[model samples]
Target: MSKNNKISALSEKDGVNKPEILSSQVAKHIQAFRKKEILATELIEKIIAGDKVALSRAITLIESTNNNHLEKANAVINGCLPFANKSVRIGITGVPGVGKSTFIEAFGKHLTGLGKKVAVLAIDPSSTLSHGSILGDKTRMEELVKDENAFIRPSASGESLGGVARKTREAIILCEACGFDTIIIETVGVGQSETAVHSMVDFFLLLKIAGAGDELQGIKRGIMEMADAVVINKADGDNIQKAKMAKVEFNRALHFFPPKSSGWQPKVTTCSAVTTDGIAAVYDLILEYISHTTTSGYFDAKREEQNQYWMLETINEQLKNSFYNHPEIIKQLELVKQQVLNHEISPFSGAQLLLEAFKKKT
Candidate 1:
């Protein structure tokens, strides 16, 4: 049969009248308009309106690994940038048994009672085997979990240094833009991660338990030096005396170090999260520090420095990602590794070869 005859017969069989391209295009446009793809502008508006669901969705976008979502995340952040950096960022670290979650529950409730909104960006330790969060912070922070003014997000740090999640700084910006006045970043109590957390926050807190050896608390002198405040938890019951002694020791240890760049001395305080005793005092100390630093212009300067540090860190991370993810590098990476193992090429030379290959491809 002729092609035109076949087409006409098939079109008639399908009950076709005019199968028009213009009609299909109009339908496509209507569908596109009806589909309602989420926009960066709409998300930003919902976030600024203090909608928690929108806030959570924005964080999820920021944490997403999909390249397509990366642009949207950046857009959300860029949109929110003007509203960010207005809040206090506090980094909290402690050994596993020091009741960190309990303390956070008490602290968050206390802050909300004062009409402050609190957001906790907690880094939970992931299993080396399964790579899942070991501690469920929401279950642990029972009271704060029920508070409308409190937001708790647990990020599993899978094989990351010091159990600090990769996207925590970005999460902080999201929370702040959504109008949370206080952001508490809770890191898994490994000593190495304190530097990572400290670099991102305005104040770094070291939470310690009484009667625990330096080894027990996993706190090194260097970590101690990084702390803006050393708060000894579990200060009630029969442990009060020991807590006091620990405070003195911490104060003495802090005295031996040179003063911080801000010239603000690190303080040692005792608190009982269970009893809520001295909890207010701990926050008072924080307020006092903020007041002194703000009056001295150190608070603003410190935050500005943090922003610069994060920018450089982000650049480094992106360079490493691009280097490893380039097609040319991926193809040769295994061969380069084998050569290094066989001593056929020096490690530095192998690295240079791969880097040159990547550069050429780019």
Candidate 2:
């Protein structure tokens, strides 16, 4: 047989385990990313110069769990920071059947038609059993996925609450560095994750549909309250009248909420992606909001607030990891759990003991 196969057979004959050999295809990619060969600073420069491949690789680096890759990723992000926060960040969320993908495809096309560069960072829910993402929603935006002026990335919601989305917020900075003017952060919209998306975006758009009946419309009021604007999708043909009525209802509903921090009233509008009607109105509304907020200085203030929030979030995350991953904490965690469960120690006492153990690591 072949030399490698013969060697394997000989190893088996000798009752020895053969060493794992890297596949040639995998070796090609491995060789391409050899350590220190391509500096992260070089990648950052290429990304700032609008190199698509470099941006993609930089994002991959950020998403990597490898310690070296993490260092490189942070370096690249820090380098890109000076050029970031230039783009308008929009957050979109809706029920599963609210036609979010279709709306984004049509809306993205509209923006690109106006000569705007767009980037869509969508969060996909991970499968609990497999711990993998089911990335079917992003594919639904086929046109946006193919647009040369657009970059679409689907990240798994695998990190802490809003953690993946926070990474997405970082990705927005990268996209802005690459000269993308518009950044849309789309959430899975199937869980409490909408709060995470709302916290990061400059403007939050809540997508809704008509004819779902009152008290059972599938969207929570807290979500509605969190929105800066509500857009009813699929407003075509038979649904046009229903959508118009829904818009009126939403406007009335929004009137009851307290004034927004931005001093801008939330709007309700109807749009039909299938017919491309009202898409321009939605875009125009975004511009209006941006102009109004910029004039009022709310835009800059909001971004600064987001930065402050992220700083605290990063601190909390790091502290938790440090506490939990401490060797003493890791060793005693099970014992504390058993003590609390068996009533040998109170829950607070058990926690304090663990914290004491974790403090010793310092």
Candidate 3:
């Protein structure tokens, strides 16, 4: 038969109808699941039981902007607090094209192989204008995503890293409560995200690439100072020598900075994500740092400090949200903004007017 006749046979009037790809029962179950309302107490119980689904739902609740969700999320977080802070929180960052995702995948696999439960909070960069994110972490870390011991959650870094940090910190608590012994927060390598991530993690790792021409320039930024360990990725092929050179340069620059409060010196190393070279050494280094900090009492002290920082950050976030969401403030903000733009009022005056209006409403 000709190609046209062969194709026509399948769609003939008397041909069998296509089978249902989705089962009716399964469809109904999905709909019911979507409509199911989980109480904060139930969520907390399930999360403590190490249910990944429940943990994800709780994080979603925390990220939601709905007032009801915010209240429920707070309740869940409070309930999970007793079980939190038990995990090692590590923050990983690097400039774009530094193979952060690839390295993280390899490192996560190594951790899982050692019988560690790892939860990665990968923050995808959001477009400033559109506020959309690629959220491709699962794609980039395909192996880790499939590993049963590793949970990878991609969150959008919307507008500012402050908001992302708040949500991520809460997510960390949830992840720990879910019995994840290791929590890795992967943030965008640029801007203020590093500072925000640095404040929340027990250890901060800065990823770099060999021959990227950023080693010296990066030294000028505070990221180098914040780094607990710097790992130059993609060290395979002929670039291995260059990576070694970069490591030496990083080490030399690190020595010029003041000693860390933790009394642990930062180390520079090189690794290859593809070949899995030097990956184990990186984990060993992190373990060594953790041991040193824990023995020196800096581990718990830093966590206490982070908790205080989180408290103040939460207050600021709440006040900012309340101000913008206040009915009076929202109503007057446009007019005040126009007045400022038209030179009828100074910028600070407009801000004061909004603040006063917000205060009155409160």
Stretches of candidate 1 exceeding 4 Å from the true structure: 1-37, 215-220
Model 2 misplaced regions, further than 4 Å = 1-37, 162-166, 214-221
Candidate 2 clashes between residue pairs 3 or more apart in a chain or in different chains: none
**lDDT, model 2:** 0.83
Error of 1 at 318 (Å): 1.1
Model 2: per-residue Cα lDDT over 1-362, one tens digit each: 78755664335444677776988898888878675456988988999998888888787777765545667788899999998888889999987888888888899999999999998888887766686887775578887888889988888877547434447767887889998999988888875878878778888998988887741332446887788888999999999999999888888888887888889998989999889899999989999999999999999998888889878887886688678777888899999999999999999999999888777679
Q: Give the TM-score (vs. native) of candidate 1.
A: 0.87
TM, every model: 0.87, 0.87, 0.92
Q: Which ten residues in a row have the lowest lDDT in candidate 3?
A: 157-166
Off by over 4 Å in 3: 1-20, 23-29, 162-166
Q: What is the full ranking by lDDT, best candidate first?
A: 3, 1, 2
User: Model 1: per-residue lDDT, tens digit, 147-210?
Assistant: 9999999888876677888788888888998999999999898877889999898888889998
Winner by lDDT: 3
**After aligning candidate 1 to the native by TM-score, how far in Å is the CA of 146 from where it should be?**
1.0
Weakest lDDT window of 10 consecutive positions for candidate 1? 7-16
